[model samples]
Target: MAFRRYLKPRVVPQEVEQIVDALPHHNVGSQGYDPWGLNLDTAKISFTAVRWLYEHYFRVEAHGLENVPADGRLLLIGNHSGQLPMDGVMAAYAIATNPHGPRLPRTMVERWFPTVPFLGNFINQVGGVVGDPKNCGKMLEREEAIIVFPEGIRGSGKPYRLRYQLQRFGHGFMHLAMEHRTPIVPMGIVGCEETMPSVTNIKPLARMLGVPYFPLAPLVPLPAKVHICFGEPMHFPDDARDEGEVERRVERVKDAIRDLIDQGLAKRRGKF
Candidate 1:
């Protein structure tokens, strides 16, 4: 009962309906299974709930929607935080609610995430797939929007003290961008670091559960306000295939996200 205090006020029903009414309506998966097996009907229905959670409960305020390409295949890379999946959902919801046509990203969820009962199925129903190269490449080839956390499990598990400190990123995303001639959109998520504020990892328990680091945090997430900032889209030549070049590109993207994080944190005035 004490943890109930952490729950934020939900969005008014009327407002949620109004926002849903205003969302862009088009058959994204009508032709067939979207890049990942996303069901258009399911995604639209899920969007309604996500909208409430994103705009009303979490009160996520987004900046730089203009930077998100209004169209085309895109790779969204950002820092992954929060002991739970709230950060990813907020990021995904933020993109989905973009007033500029609401581009719902096909997020690349970790393989383990899909094994979590209902939560995993809901993710898949709305276009989330295992973060496999083949799956990602297929999506890129189809020119679908993709959101990736290069930091992977490690980023989401760092101690609370290391919150918002960007983790080392893998270079695969850059290679994919170059191969597909798709642009990379670097994004930064603020306030998520303190959602549960992991103090330690219960390693043995986590291993037994077959999950990554188990965050030892409060029973409920703190009502931390969330902010998502999208950096300018970056492009790599499709023909550039040098390993060294890919590493440099990956670093450059990481630096851009770091800058955005600094700016967002400054804007947040150290609330968390």
Candidate 2:
């Protein structure tokens, strides 16, 4: 008689809802109000969190902060390189720590992030909203400071093959800027690439874990010193009403960010 073996079925993991019930609840429609709004109090809290992490844990150095506007609807465009989303957190910290009437800029993040377990809840608490065009427009309409990484996940997940090189930026941000007449500020973030140098891809594991993409970084602890530099605000020409003209302005912003990154990398070569 042949021996028979029985194996238990494997359990497929389902996405767990991670929304924080403890946080103050507000209608999605009333995202502009004080109680559930992007006001100074909330911004200060977020600033404190990021600052504490940077000072105590990362020791990040930030320069060219004057480039951030004191008040108005402005779009901060920057390169993403951190193995994790630490760059965004640090950028938020920078804005919150600005001495010249500091304000926490609302960040537009990937839509999928809100579905993650603990991360989604924490990001939302820090005033990070979904990176959809509609959400961006609404925030701009309220004259809020919005930060965006046009390269999306591709920039954040930059492989060792394309370190510091920017990916193709989507044009939706440009259209929103033109429509809202908001100034575009270009910023360059360095050292995040070194924090975690992604050398390979692990698709099967990433899928199993329910993450959009998984990266293999040889440098797990991120020994490189982190530095972020801001460039002078670049405004879109009001006279350029044509779509083509608007595109030119968008490209200009992208170029400015690229140039700043190159300059920053050059400055930090020996140290980083």
Candidate 3:
């Protein structure tokens, strides 16, 4: 009991503990774990560790968080960059700390992530789920908020020259939104592109590692000030049929994200 007390305070400071404890956890079992593998204790520790990066290091500025619904299933779609998943981390932090309604949004991670030993379980404990449609559907059915990067590796592995220019978005998110009748909150993330700009990708290395792409970038992300703007919630009719209709809906969300990105870029004073 003494050891537990010592470990908890050291790993999770009182301030960080309060911040995490304030988050609305839904469907959590008596053991502090949800069906999707979210462990409340694990989440508290992870949040405490990342709080420094989100607050002082990156100095993330979030706007339009009021637009995110205080309750109900939500889809937070955004552009991906930084040669890593830091953009998703910052966005999730912003939403989790939002004064209006603090909630831990589940982030959809790449399939390759689960193939890595230990990393997969660590991710799941911190509220990350494999980017599978079936899993996402189940979460939505339970009225959970999810963060999705439709650009996938294409955006994250893009060269520095293509930074801020969103890559092609997959239509799967649109299809899910339409089917679930969930509100889509378009998010624009800036500064992450410069955090660890990739000059090129080594396909051979990526193939050997069995990952999407191996980026030629810094080992650690530079502390680039990040800006995350959440746009007004967008809704699509559930009656959509045909691929073209879904594509059109996806395009609309992309446009909204693009506009928000432009705004964030304009508002940015410096990269670091």
Candidate 4:
């Protein structure tokens, strides 16, 4: 759905509220994380927000969560869908409230997000840091679980007609996993693309409105049921040191996610 508003942009809290309203509702004050030696409360809020989104806004049916390790610096690489970042939110929610227990996963967010008043505060409070190489390395060194969508913006912004094809992922995440000897866990998120069938992009309009990007969808409020599937953890040999090997492993993980997305899509389709 195309959202064109001509109202004057409000300031601070109001602006934040407007942004939040434009997307899904979340519980912003519940979970947190410790990164860069800074004990930020934003992580907890982010966790809570995601949990609230699953509990209230979206009907999420998660499977194969037993595949996630209970602890360590694990990398979760997944397919990014939806015009917005709701797919990430749904995955975060599944991890936090796994039937096994409460475990918070820290995510790397874009640097630009935190500069937008309350939105920035909210992101930081939820343990989301700038997607800088230095910060990502630091988090890995600390043995914290990290979630990355290596496709950058492409996976999240693909045209509706091209849903499910894995985008070209940056090698940073694979490099980090090899360096830290962390396992790469693959996650597949379904239904978000159907929620908002964003088929086109209006970049100039987005810039004029001071937003990152604007999407055109067939539905205003997406009613698609969301599903998240976690694949078996894939481990890299601690002594493995070849760059080509790393790339191959990353592709394997990507392939697994694609399969899961297909499975999820089929499962949801069968139910109807």
Best by lDDT: 3
Q: Please, what's the RMSD in Å of model 4?
A: 8.4
Tens-place lDDT per residue, model 4, 93-139, is 67766666435566777666777787765565555667787777777
TM-score leaderboard ranking: 3, 1, 2, 4
Model 3: worst 10 consecutive residues (lDDT sum): 1-10
TM-score of 2: 0.78
Off by over 4 Å in 1: 1-35, 239-241, 270-272
The TM-score, computed over Cα atoms with residue i paired to residue i, of candidate 4 is 0.78
RMSD of each candidate relative to the true structure: 5.6, 11.1, 1.7, 8.4
Error of 1 at 166 (Å): 1.2
In model 1, residue pairs whose N, Cα or C atoms come closer than 3 Å (at least 3 residues apart or on different chains), thus clashing, are none
What does candidate 1's lDDT look like per residue over 1-272, in tens digits?
Answer: 12212322232355544544454334344553443566544555566677767767677888998888766789999999887777778887777667776766778888898888877776886778899888888877766788999999888888889988888898888888887889999998898887789889999999999998888898887878888899999988865557777778888999999998887887785444
Ten residues in sequence with the least summed lDDT for candidate 1 = 1-10
Stretches off by above 4 angstroms in model 4 are: 1-33, 36-49, 209-212, 218-221, 238-244, 270-272
lDDT of 2 by residue, 25-57 (tens): 233244433322333233334444555567765
1-272 in candidate 3: lDDT tens per residue? Answer: 35434666678888888887888877898888899999877777788868989999999999999999878999999999988899998999999989889888999999989889989988998999999999999999999999999999989889999989989999889888988999999999999999999989999999999999999999999999999999999999888778988888899999999999999999999889
In angstroms, give how far residue 178 of model 2 lies from its true place: 0.4
In model 2, which regions exceed 4 Å deviation?
A: 1-49, 218-221, 237-246, 269-272
Ranking by lDDT: 3, 1, 2, 4
Clashes of 2: 0
